[model samples]
Target chain A: MFHLLDIIGTIAFAMSGALTAMNKKLDLFGVFIIAFVTAVGGGTLRDVMIGRTPVGWMLDLEYVYVICFAFVLTLVFRKKFEKLRTSLFLFDTIGLGVFTLIGLEKGISVGLHPTICIALGTMTACFGGVIRDILCAEIPVIFRKEIYATICILGGIVFFLLKSFHLDNDILYLITSLVIISVRLMAVKFKWYLPTLEKN
Target chain B: MFHLLDIIGTIAFAMSGALTAMNKKLDLFGVFIIAFVTAVGGGTLRDVMIGRTPVGWMLDLEYVYVICFAFVLTLVFRKKFEKLRTSLFLFDTIGLGVFTLIGLEKGISVGLHPTICIALGTMTACFGGVIRDILCAEIPVIFRKEIYATICILGGIVFFLLKSFHLDNDILYLITSLVIISVRLMAVKFKWYLPTLEKN
Candidate 1:
């Protein structure tokens, strides 16, 4: 079940990355590279920091295959992507939720501090987009525009809070991910955003 | 010693990052973060990819101290930074050479392929600047403007070529770094740059 969610998230992220690269007028190679990075960059970073060798994607060729499939899908349906935006957004939110939980679980398994765990969670869920924006030569949208990472951090907190009660592992994971996904949905529906930082 | 060169490289990279951030009109905190990233970002990325846990700076606080020192020095001497440009450039070039060597050695220790080791070397010596540029909302200057990474790649090849001759470790490292440094110096002196790619 977790693996299924992960694959869904990777596909969403990869398509979004491809779309962004196309919007930027990048070459085909550049588009594919961006797609791959957005799909796995966060988990790769997390794995590296936690000393997980060969990285998650490198160890599993499944990710590469999925990303390639996503790339082709995006390119083929570029014109219809506008209509698919809502669906894409839904998948992206799912990705955000699942990736955050994965990061939190990895950090907990490594016995990292709770604060560090939360940070890892946020990074896993958001840094792919952060890297995507950066490669497209823009400040990361998360740092300025959205309530995205805040949801992951909150979800992480809730996970730990529930863990204190010795909740079932499966229940804990489900609840945390649901919390993140719902909050993200609400945030978007309500048009919630962070205040832009002004030059002082 | 390698350690001493690494420190010098860290200080130079940190100050350069600080200087760039200040030029972008970032607040003090922003400047410090950029400095920290510029000094250690490449090595952190390299370490993470190679599964080096805790990372170099996390294990030793010396990197943090030197970066702080560099931050202060850059801010205080901001007015005179123009005068120090040549010296700073020299230091940055030295960093490029030394960092490439460190990365190459680490790859060899890990028993990676020669090609992968060269890539690791280039990443160690160049990715900090790439990340800095990305954060600053510009395409990485190295990707377009300079012969910087090419030198590191060449240096890596040279290192391996000399290794095939059974050269002593000290002499091998010295020659390889010298090759990188001198080539970079000449590249700059000759104003050598890669041709820019146009949007197709």
Candidate 2:
């Protein structure tokens, strides 16, 4: 069940990345590479930081296949999906929530502190997008006055707190995911933003 | 002192990165950011992987100043520097050697195993350039059939063996840097390259 959600999240993330490349009018190889990076970059970073051997993608070749498939599918549908911005953002938002939950769950299971787990969750959900934006030569929207990573951290904390109360594992994951997705979507809809460069 | 050498290395690295960005005709802000990232990205990655808090740049504001200074200098001498690829490559090579030695020294100071120390050294000295090239939308030459990273690792091992023999710190740094720089320069002069993968 968990694996199913993970694959769904991976496909969604890859599609979002590929859509961004399409929007930018990059070549086919460029689109594939960006999509692959967006889908795997965050987990690779998290694993590397934690000293996890082989990295997540190296351990599972299926991830490469998934990213390739996503890239091809996006290319095939490029004309039909001309209005890709809204749909891509929606997919990316879904991925953000689910990936945050999974990252927090993995970190806690590995015996990390709660603060670190929250950080891990935020990184897992956001770093890939950060890298994507950086490579596309743009300032990272996620870090500068965006409510994106903050939503992930809040959702991660909720998971730990609920789990500590002996909640069902499935219930914990669902509620965590729901909270994040709802908060992020609502923020986008309302054009919400965090204060940037807070005054002392 | 090490701080002085670090500043020199930063200037060289930033100038190299800025030159590449200028070749690509990027804006002033883009050039500055690329130069800054090329200067500090590798060392920052090494420190983060080793779980070091307060990354080197955050510890000393001078690194930031160094990059800013480098940007202004590059802006002044853009045309002159552009016509001096040979000299720029020499400065870049020396910076690589210095960075490799510093990375190995930091790794040993932090008690990493010798093999991992070598890995960290190569990462610190070369990863920044790889990232810089990627951001410029070029395939990283270091990864494309080159002796770059491999040379850094070899010199790092030499550094470790000498340190283990209770060699003087200054002498060890000198010898290691010489070994790395000499081999890299020779490789370039002789047109040395690794064999490419056979096409299907």
Best candidate, DockQ-wise?
A: 1
lDDT of 1 by residue, A16-55 (tens): 9999999999999999999999999898878878787778
Q: What is the C-alpha lDDT profile of model 2 across A3-103, one tens digit per residue?
A: 76677778888887777665655545456556877898888788877766445665466887888787777767766664666776776777888889867
lDDT of 1 at A23: 92
Error of 2 at A139 (Å): 17
RMSD of each predicted structure: 6.7, 9.3
lDDT by residue (B1-200, candidate 1, tens digit) is 87888889999999989888777766565576578889988988998878788576655667878998998888778888778889999899989999999899889999999999999999999999998888889778898888899999999999999999999999999999999999999999999887777799
Candidate 1, after superposition: displacement of residue B184 in Å? Answer: 20
Instruction: Give the per-residue Cα lDDT of candidate 2 at A122.
Output: 90
Candidate 1 error regions (>4 Å)? B1-43, B49-51, B56-130, B139-200
Worst 10 residues of 2 chain B by lDDT: B191-200
Error of 1 at B87 (Å): 21
